[model samples]
Structure formats: C-alpha cells, structure tokens
Target: MTVFDLPARLDATNAPAIEQQLLRLIQTDKPALLVCNFAATDYISSAGLRILLLAAKTLRQQGAELQLRQMQPAVADVFRLAGLHGVLNIQN
Candidate 1:
C-alpha cells in the first residue's frame, strides 16, 4: 500500500502539481493500492475533483486501487455535492 498525504487545500492553484506527483508515484512505485490521505485536507475545488477523478482512472487502468481516506467534513461535503461520494472510493 502506498499513501499520499494531501495538502490542506486542493484547488486550481495546485491540483496540477499534485496530479504530476501522483502520476510519478503510480508509474515508478507501482503500488497495488494507493491511498490519498485527506486527514489534513479541509477544502477541495472542482479542479481538485478533476485531478482525483483522473488519478482514479489512471490507477484503475494500471490495475491499482485508489482509496480516499480521512476526509474532513468540508472536503467530504464537496465530494458529496459533486456526486463523487458514489463514484470514488471514499472512507471515513
């Protein structure tokens, strides 16, 4: 299992950077499972959601699983509002 700790905020300003880093991890490390730890993440925007969706898709294609964990209420709500709570593999 490989875990990536996300920043407090995931938005348009930094989603691309995070995406690149995650892609590198997926390509180089090739972990069977990837966990995006949102314990410290308080906010996430549409761009962030886009990145997560992309990551999930890429990981799936690689035969790896992506799990979103420890999401703060606000961030979780964002996912809920975006209807991603069902699309993404999220855990409390």
Candidate 2:
C-alpha cells in the first residue's frame, strides 16, 4: 500500500499539478493499493473530483486500487453530490 497526503485545497489552481503527481506515482510505483489521505483537505472543486476520477480509472486499468480516506464531511459531500461516491473507493 502507498499512502499520499492531499493538500488543504483542491481546486483548478492545483488540480493539474496534483494529477501529474498522482499519475507519476501510479506509473512509477505501480502499487497494488494507493490511499489518498484527505485529513487536511477541506475543499474540493470539480477539477479536483475530475483528477480523482481519472486517477481511479487509471489505477483500475492497471489492476490497482485507489482509496480516499479521512475526507472532511464537506469534501465527502461534494463527491456524493457529484455521484462519484459510488464510483470511487472512499472511506470515512
């Protein structure tokens, strides 16, 4: 398992960069399980959700898994409202 800590804010301003980092990690490490820690993240814009969805897809293609953990209630709500809660592996 590989664990990654997310930034406090996930918006268009940093979504692209975060995407690159996640892609790089998945490509380089090829971990069977990738866990993103959202303990510090309180905000998530649509852009952030997009990257996460992309990451989850990419990981699935590699027969790996992406897990989101400790998300704030608000952030989790964003995912839920976007209908991503069922698509991604999120753990409260």
Candidate 3:
C-alpha cells in the first residue's frame, strides 16, 4: 500500500502540493495508504477541508484506500464541526 504522508500544515500555502500528491497517488493503478499528518495544523477552513473530501471521493471512485491519521484535536474538531467525521475515516 502507498502512504501519502502530509505535512503538519496544509493551508492554502501548501494546498497545491497536497493536491499534486493526492492526484498522483489516486491515478496509480494500485491500492494505497494515505496517512495524513495534521498534528501541527491547528486550523482548517472549508476550502482546505474540501481537499480531503475531494481526495477521499476520488480514491473511492478509483477503488483505492485513503486513511487519515494522527489528526490534531483541533483539526478533528474541524471535521466534526463540518460533519465529515463519518464521511472520512480519521484514525484515532
């Protein structure tokens, strides 16, 4: 499985980088493990969250696995606040 290791910060400044990495992995003709790191990210806006949703949706369509892990309490709260905790599987 492929693992997409994300940085602590994933704001607009590095969204493109994350986008590129995600797109590259999803297009691959094999299963993958996307372990996103958000431990240092204290904030995430709607647009930023959209990136995760998009990635997960795309991966699902492509029959790949995307697992998010080590999410900061603040960041996980963002998912709960946005009502996406159930939509995406954020490792505990």
RMSD of each: 0.6, 0.5, 1.9
Ten residues in a row with the worst lDDT in model 1?
A: 77-86
Candidate ranking (lDDT, best to worst): 2, 1, 3
**Cα deviation in Å at residue 53, candidate 1?**
0.5
Q: Estimated TM-score per prediction?
A: 0.97, 0.98, 0.82
Candidate lDDT (C-alpha), each: 0.93, 0.95, 0.76
Winner of 2 and 3 under TM-score: 2
Candidate closest to the true structure, highest TM-score: 2
Residue lDDT tens for model 1, 1-92: 99999999999999989999999999999988999999999989999999889989999999989999999988998898889988999988
Give the winner by lDDT: 1 or 3. 1
lDDT of 1: 0.93
Q: Quantify how close model 2 is to the true structure by its C-alpha RMSD in Å.
A: 0.5
lDDT of 1 at 35: 97
| Per-residue alpha-carbon lDDT of candidate 2 for residues 1-92, written as tens digits (9 for 90 to 100) | 99989999999999999999999999999999999999999999999999998999999999999999999999999998999888999998
Error of 1 at 24 (Å): 0.5
